[model samples]
Target: MTNELPVISLFAGAGGLDCAVERCAEPPLVHDGSGSPLRVRVATDYDGTALQTLARNFPHTKTILEDIRTVSTSDLLKVAGLSKGEPTLVVGGPPCTPFSKSGFWIEEKRNSQDPNASLLDEYVRVVSEAQPEAFVLENVQGLTYRTHQEQLRRLITGLRESGYSVEYKVLLAAEYGVPQLRRRVFVVGRRDGKPFHFPPITHSGESERDREYDPSKLPFVGVKEVFDGLPATPENGEIADGTFGELAAEVPPGQNYLWHTDRYGGRPVFKWRSRYWTFLLRLDPDRPSTTVQAQPGPWVGPFHWENVPNADGEMRARRLRVPELKRIMTFPDEFEFIGDRREVQRQIGNAVPVELGKVVIRALMEQMGYLDPLGDGARPEQVQETLLF
Candidate 1:
């Protein structure tokens, strides 16, 4: 029998989570002395642009460029060379916009004829049909909000009825070594009655409210820790060429346009506290970054705080370059993104943080007895040393 467990990925945008699962069975990150890494037999995604990016990075995997609704469990299993009872793991992050509080409310969207609302159902259908030994579903934390409790209940019930014991938690990416404060909900299910335990937090922030201070944990990585080494922007850094550019110049690091004053050259065109929190937001060098939005508007941000010397030697602000954003998302530098500027940003922003994914999958591996529980797995140093870029 093969030592490596096969994996089937769905809605695998840019394969950030897949990359993490793949690494669990590979070098420095590998916990068990397994002969080969986890085999990603098949991956499916509906977005052509995202599929292109996934195929580019994982050329060896059989990437199905089709909607998950149209693909059958038998087809996925056949492609993966697995039988009904074979050991396998299915992982995916369904489209979150339907349930994202940042977007539309789930209840309101459910009342409307939103096509994406049924995506969670489709994900459940695949798991039911495949009946894998275990499955992991990732989604926006809004799924667990009190207002969406009914939806959450139905989801858990549906998975349980499919013969799996499930547990879920909202995980902060920064606590898991990612340099961004992105919290995502992960639902893990095992058909064999085994309960899934989350991995312990490996990092903490200075703020008491951020997390309980633990001397054993590493301090949260700051924006400067990652961005300082990159190339500097031009003196008149490339601004967004509109009102955004005008407002961005006035906002300082760690603050948004809302903090702009009507003094000096700064013009306060926007009403104070009227704009969304993301507008003209700049990263703070000392703190972890805010969540990276899937589509950053001409004015909205998670923008960089990089300053360039203007003609008068004055410092000026500029929006972050795509590469800098990718780093914030925890993608390896060498990982290629194959799309136009907007499409690439969407793929990167929509991805699971690579470090977060590694932590989750490593926990699953240990739970399944595939790896030694006591093994020194998924250390930040090991991840950093093994990063291709």
Candidate 2:
């Protein structure tokens, strides 16, 4: 059973979490005493584009491109080659739009009865029916807001009644090695009544620094660190030649268009602080990026603080390329995304950072007594090429 623990991945967008699981099963993360690595028995998603990306990256795994609501546990088990009572692991991050802070504030759609909001129930249904040895559920932190606390309680209670011990926490992705400040909630459940320990933070910032300063806490990764080596490009591949591009040039690093002034030919079209922070937001180069949106507007930001020398030797601003965005999201350089530009942005933005996934799953493995103490000493670079085609 060294590398055969069956895994069923639901809503597997671009297979980010799946990639992390695969990495953990094989390398430095999983050494001599670790239990068998998880094998992707089946991966399911309703989005055709996402499934295409998953297939491109994980050609060996069986993928189901169908709505979860229409799929039965028996069918999933059949595909996974697992018996009804066999040990298995189910993992998913259902679309969080329904319970997202942005979605919750959208007056008309705030009702919990909205179809999208009910997908959590679908996730629970699948876990109850599958009766897996363990399961991992991930979602946006807004789900734990006081308004949605009842839903959270019901979810935990339902899982407990179903015979799995459940524990949860809101985890910061930056702490887990992702180069952004993304907070997500994770719920882990096990059939054997074992409690899951959340992984300790491996990276910290000024806030954490005020507490006990541990020598092991690495400094937070900055935007500059990730982008320093790549060649510079403008809004559409070269220097920005449009009005919006010109405005971006005037905005300084770390500041948004709000800093623009009439003296510099800039106009205040929008009221101050009225727009979302992403509007004209530029990266600081010294700090981790703000959250990457799944769908950024034509002028929305967390835009790169990229600049290239002009004829006079002055630097000018430009938008981030698709590849740069992927790097910021912590996706492997070799991971191939399949879709039009907009769709690709959505897929990447919606994905769980692979680094964060590795930390969380490693914690789960340890808590379940599946970890071996011996070191494999194999790094990610050594194994990534073999895992992705």
Candidate 3:
């Protein structure tokens, strides 16, 4: 029996979790002859631009464009073609701006006061009402910070009241082969109260300190490798042309504005620790990209490594294009973004990397007996996806 799991997605920006969970739903073994074990039934979000993109990518899912606060749990189930308690899985990350680690990194104000903070409750509310076999909650790692401990306590208590045995951890996206260093927290719950096994790190750093990981693990994917072959328009020469823009090309790959800092062994063009870490960040071909920003300033970057010439033939470093960002974020090559440039980038920045979600969701399914192991003895998670377009 397929015994399909009906998946409902909330705060479903750009369908990153949906993409990964979709991969998990597909039966891994060919001869098993079972249909997909999980199905995404509905994806709901407040942003029309984001829902527009989600609908295009996941047309199989019913899209509801409404604020989660106003969207009733019964309505959500009905839209998913499900009755209460009939769903297999529900997944989403409420908007994380309230808990994001920006200037408010340690601010006590990063609490339930912000209007966005209420969205977390909305996630728990839906899961409580739907009573799925399991639910996954994604958010910025900052939620686990000491200042927000009260909220975290309430969240755990809220889910446990509904009989969920919850497990959570801060996961590194690069460790799962996404070509970027993104840190996020995932909270998973099982209605059966069985212990849930989070995905293991199948990829690791090559450094000696990283030897603690299983040696057979693959190296963390590099940005250059992920961008091996993609189209670009250096002729248009979207050069980093502000005051520091001209210096972007000179800073060398993988180094940021700190490249010119005295402490970093370069000429002290700027004071040590004077700028934000991302002020002039450039990609290192051999390293995974730093976390991309939702609203990067003109000079903020993990800028492209290959300096390209403008129409005048002057070679200069340029900001990353949409195509490269998608690869780094593990969005498939053909997936289309439905908004203007800034809005599109914001969706990508806010998403859980598709590969990272796939690793976690697949492991969860396998451990829970929803997925079968390969006859050849290799688990589905063992087979890494290139995620190439």
Give me the displacement of residue 60 in model 3, in angstroms.
1.6
Best-to-worst order by lDDT is 3, 1, 2
Tell me the TM-score of model 3.
0.88
Question: How many Å off is the CA of 32 in candidate 3?
Answer: 18
Residue-wise C-alpha lDDT for candidate 1, range 148-169, written one tens digit per residue: 6766787898899999999999
Candidate 2's displacement at residue 183, Å, is 0.8
Range of the 10 consecutive residues with the lowest summed lDDT in candidate 1: 27-36
The positional error of residue 171 in candidate 2, measured at the CA in angstroms, is: 0.9
Top lDDT model = 3
**Order the candidates by TM-score, highest first — what do you get?**
3, 1, 2
Query: Candidate 1 has which clashing residue pairs, if any?
Result: none
In candidate 1, clashing pairs total 0
TM-score of each: 0.86, 0.85, 0.88
* Candidate 3 displacement at residue 82 in angstroms: 1.0
